[model samples]
Target: MITVSACMIVKNEERVLARCLDSLKGLVDEIILVDTGSTDGTKEIAKKYNCKIYDFKWIDDFAAARNFSFSKAAMDYIFVADADEVIDEVNREKFLTLKQHLIPEIDIIQMMYANQLEFNTTYNFDKEYRPKLFKRLRQFTWTDPIHETVMLDPVVYDSEIEILHMPENNHAVRDFDIFQRLIQKGTAFSEKLISMYARELFIAGEDKDFLTAESFFTGLLEQEVSEEVIKLIQCILVRCGRIKNDSELILRYALKNIATGKASAEVCYEVGEYFYNKDNIKEAVIWYMNAAFETDAELNIHYNKELPLEKIALCYEKAGNTEEANNYREQAAALRESLM
Candidate 1:
């Protein structure tokens, strides 16, 4: 069996820290908790878990903090998790099994990060594969100040484990503030960072921020970005146009997104929303139906599948098609029930 050290960097996470630590109690060999100026009882909570706690001064660099925490690991492998994340019983069992069978050649273990799960269905609100488990080595250091990630070798294995993130606050503005500070300090903006910065501003939804975010996203559209990122940029552009009440721009971007042949359910739903808001019931119904039936596996954001069904039901009701309306409503209800 392989020994695993659970590592984390946190501050003022007392609300969720215990939940996170409790979930890892029996799964890991050690717990390394690095506190960055916590003004709460987070350290006390860590002590309860018998975590090897160390204090570090705030440096406003997430990677530095993460690397410091990783340095304290005294096990064969490091398993990283945030203060608000948890490993459910099923995944914890799977993790133990993985440790028992893990080979020395496997440098990294990629697992699903279930960032959000739908209230009722088995559908995840948002999930992505990330390398959260890796061998303890000097060469594997985390990179990037914000949205940090490990530099892993190509020898990686995907695990059936999952880490569920349940954050109490959205922290949109707080993150945006960090990005802005980084920008002011003349940090080189990589394509990924630019995309994230634009997303933060767009989600902030301030009038001035929206204008700036729109410009940034527009600039990104012309850059050599991945198809997946292009789709996301286009989605944000569509939302920006919607905020400005520019129906022409919204339709243009939404159509472009669909033309990519990689459009997500949310992108299709945005088009449906445009037509629905304009009282074009027939056109809206087509797009809504498309969104409801979309089967793209690559889409990872908050694409509410039930929204389209409900919208189609409303469209049918407005058209005096009571039978069709009731049918779609029942479909939506059934889907929601399955989630629960």
Candidate 2:
């Protein structure tokens, strides 16, 4: 059996820390909890699990704190989790099975990070696979202070395990604040950071920031980026253009995204939205159908699935096809019910 150490960096997570730690019981050989100056009872909760808790000075860099937690691990594999995340019962069983059958040569294990599990009024169900499990001997380390990711070899294995993130505290502007601070400190932005920064500004809801975000996103497209990141950046740029009421720019980015050999659901949906805004129901329906029928899981965001269905229903309604409109609405309702 491969020994696994659960490593986490936490601060002021008293309410959720115990719940997260409880889910890891009997699943890992050890738990290393690094507290970054928590005034709450988070350390006391960690004591209940017999976790090796250590205090680390609060630094702006999250990777530094994570690396410090990893340094205390003595197991063959290191598993990272946040205080706001929990492994469900089914995924916990899968995790145990994965631990038993894990190969030594697998440098990293990609697991689903289910950002939203059930449908709520605030956010839709969002999820993606991330490399959360790593081999200790591989010397993998986390990168970036914000949106940190592990540096690992290409030999990765996908696992059925899922980590459900349930955030109780709302730190909506925290990441944007960090990005601003990094910028003020003269920190050179990486391609990934640039994409994320643009996204933050766009979501910040400032009227003037949308134009700035569009400029940054336009610059991002000129740089070499991975297909997935390119799709995400294009999605943001298209949205920004739409919000800015720049029809030509929106069409340009939307067409560019579609021409990427594999237009993602978001790209298709945005195109549908663009045509719909122009009162072209027929053309909008075609693109919305493309988004609705998209089979590539990685290419579809959570909203991509539901939004297309909803838009298609509206398009059919506008086209005076009552039966088709009702059918599409029923399908959308069923999908929403299933998610709930």
Candidate 3:
């Protein structure tokens, strides 16, 4: 059985740190905690757990802090958890099983992250994935400053190991504030900084800042850039454009990738819903037809539970496409009838 070292990075997480540490204590051979400067009992709790603690300066980049934490591991396999995340007994047992029956060739393991799984929680599924468990010898590092992710290149397997996040979304690090302050300081900073700043603006709901972000994407596109950064900028532009309903901008970006492959069914459905909400039934049907026929069933990832077939049937009837409208209505009715 491979020994597991649980690594965590934190700052002023006094409220949630103890709960997180308590969940993983005794599960791993070692617990490594790196403090970015917490004036709270977060450090005191670490001492009680005999956790090997280190100090990492508050850098605007999260990867820097996380990478620093990973360097402190002293076991064959490393497991990372956040100060606000919890791993239940069922998942912890599953993780233990994976380590005991591990294969040498599997350098990394993908973990399912379950966000907000309360018994009565309502919303679409909050399942996201990332590399959470891996071999220390592989020397995989992390990338991206804010939502940092591991950089690995060895064979990976998706284990049923899961994690739950109950983050303090309202509270943010001081560095997040600093990033926005620097955005207005000068043009000396790279477009990367601008991209990061724009994300902050979108979250904060600053209209002018969003325009600045939209401009930054345009500015970067004019320069010679890496393919990876280009794709990121395009995605950011699409999000900002949608928020502003900038039709011209949306059409331009859509055209870039629209014909290279089929347009996204989800996007078309959203468009149809947008018009339907405005009571523009005619435009809604046109977009909905374009969506359902042109796009595949797989592309409507979470629409069934959220919008469901009955809603689609209702939209068609509202648009007065009686024949096709009735077909959808019957389908939805049959589903409901079968449930009874």
lDDT of each: 0.77, 0.76, 0.66
Writing each residue's lDDT as its tens digit, candidate 2 over 59-104 gives 5678899999999999999999899889889999999999898877
Segments of candidate 2 deviating more than 4 angstroms? 1-3, 37-39, 57-60, 88-133, 138-164, 169-173, 183-212, 222-231, 258-264, 274-287, 293-304, 318-320, 334-340
Clash pairs of candidate 2? none
Pick out the ten consecutive residues of candidate 1 with the lowest summed lDDT: 116-125
Q: What's the candidate order when arranged by decreasing lDDT?
A: 1, 2, 3
Runs in model 1 deviating more than 4 A are 57-60, 88-101, 112-115, 119-129, 138-153, 162-164, 169-212, 258-265, 293-304, 336-340
lDDT of 2 at 127: 70
What lDDT does candidate 3 reach at residue 102?
Answer: 91
Tens digits of per-residue lDDT for model 3, 56-103: 887555778888888999899898888888889998898778878998
- Across 1-340, the per-residue lDDT of candidate 1 in tens digits comes to 9999999989899999999999998899999999988899999999988999999887667889999998899999999988988899999899989989998878889999785443221234457688999889635568789999986645789888888878886666666667667656766567667656644543344655666556656766666788777776777777667667788888788888878766667667767787888899999998787777863422323344566889999999999999999998998888766644
What overall lDDT, based on C-alpha atoms, would model 3 receive against the true structure? Answer: 0.66
- For model 3, the superposed segments whose C-alpha errors exceed 4 Å read 99-106, 116-129, 138-157, 168-212, 223-245, 255-257, 265-279, 288-293, 296-340
Winning model by lDDT: 1
TM-scores of the candidates are 0.76, 0.70, 0.65
How far out, in Å, is residue 199 in model 3? 10
